[model samples]
Target: MKRPYKKTDLPVWQVRKFLEPGPIVLVSSHWQGKNNIMAMGWHTVLEFSPSLLGCMITSANHSFDMVRKSGECVINIPTADMIDTIIAIGNSHGPRVNKFTRFGLTPEPAATVKAPLIRECYANIECRLADRRLVDKYNFFIFEVLKAQAATYPAYPKTVHYRGEGVFMVSGKNIAMPEKFRKGNL
Candidate 1:
């Protein structure tokens, strides 16, 4: 058994550094002949069946209004190698900049949404707004994944996850123990 380590009080706002879930995905939105990409880390998988994903997009973000009005967006998972691109996109403004052109990212037409997929990313999930109940209160958007695609070369791409305050961690290794789980759990 391992020994318990000493603990220290953490600020409530800084708790995200330890509680941040999932990878930093690039959300693509298109509305009124414009397309934009923004990096998002505040998202979670709500359900497995029908593929529900909940993302918190601050109202101040340019993609928020575009996604709200268009009712659709594409969530693209980028590999760890594209960390620089992700940071650039997150730091830049949307309306004044064309991310696809500025970042030299190829935009491919999505099958179920107007938003284009980033060809360089490992996977792209097309989503449609399913619920807006929390949008006004928390700027949260529940989306039902309509279509998903991924690269077959790497079983799982090395994804980058935020740790707050300009720090990031890259996904490493996979430990599969499906047999240890109860029948349908895996």
Candidate 2:
């Protein structure tokens, strides 16, 4: 029999911490020809065919307005070396500051979207908004990946992952399962 659900004895935050870490993506959006970027830790892959979905931005963020209006964004995955730049952009308000200019970051034109990609980042995933209702109440934006580009960093293949408020961890090691398990045999 299944055990009863109990909240009184469990630490909910600890349970959330158990999830597999994902990359720290810098989501760029353009509005009225002006561009902006903000670091986001809440993003995921939700589809394969035509590629789609999942990004979360607080309702109060300025980037939220830009993204909603433009319907396009570029997700740039930075490296471990970009921690300082990521923290700076994540902590500041775009309305009051031009992060790209202030941080000495370079922006490269994206092929399919108005939003530009951060040149220093390791990877760029250009996307168009697939759904905005996701952001209406949950602060999440679902998008369809239109294009992707990666820097020539063969040594460090993965992107950075934000641990919490100010802590971040890099992709450390890789482990592959046996072919039997890979095919659901084990």
Best by lDDT: 1
Per-model lDDT: 0.95, 0.82
Clashes by residue pair, model 1: none
| Model 1 per-residue lDDT tens digits across residues 38-104 | 9999999999997999999999999999999999999999989999999999999898999999999
Candidate 2: regions farther than 4 A off:
1-10, 155-158, 181-186
RMSD of each: 0.8, 4.3
Each candidate structure's TM-score, on Cα atoms with residue i matched to residue i, is 0.98, 0.86
Candidate 2 residues 127-183, lDDT tens each?
999888767889888999989988765756656776664566778786766764755
Off by over 4 Å in 1: none
Worst 10 residues of 2 by lDDT: 12-21
Clashes of 1: 0
Return the TM-score for candidate 1, rounded to 2 decimals.
Answer: 0.98
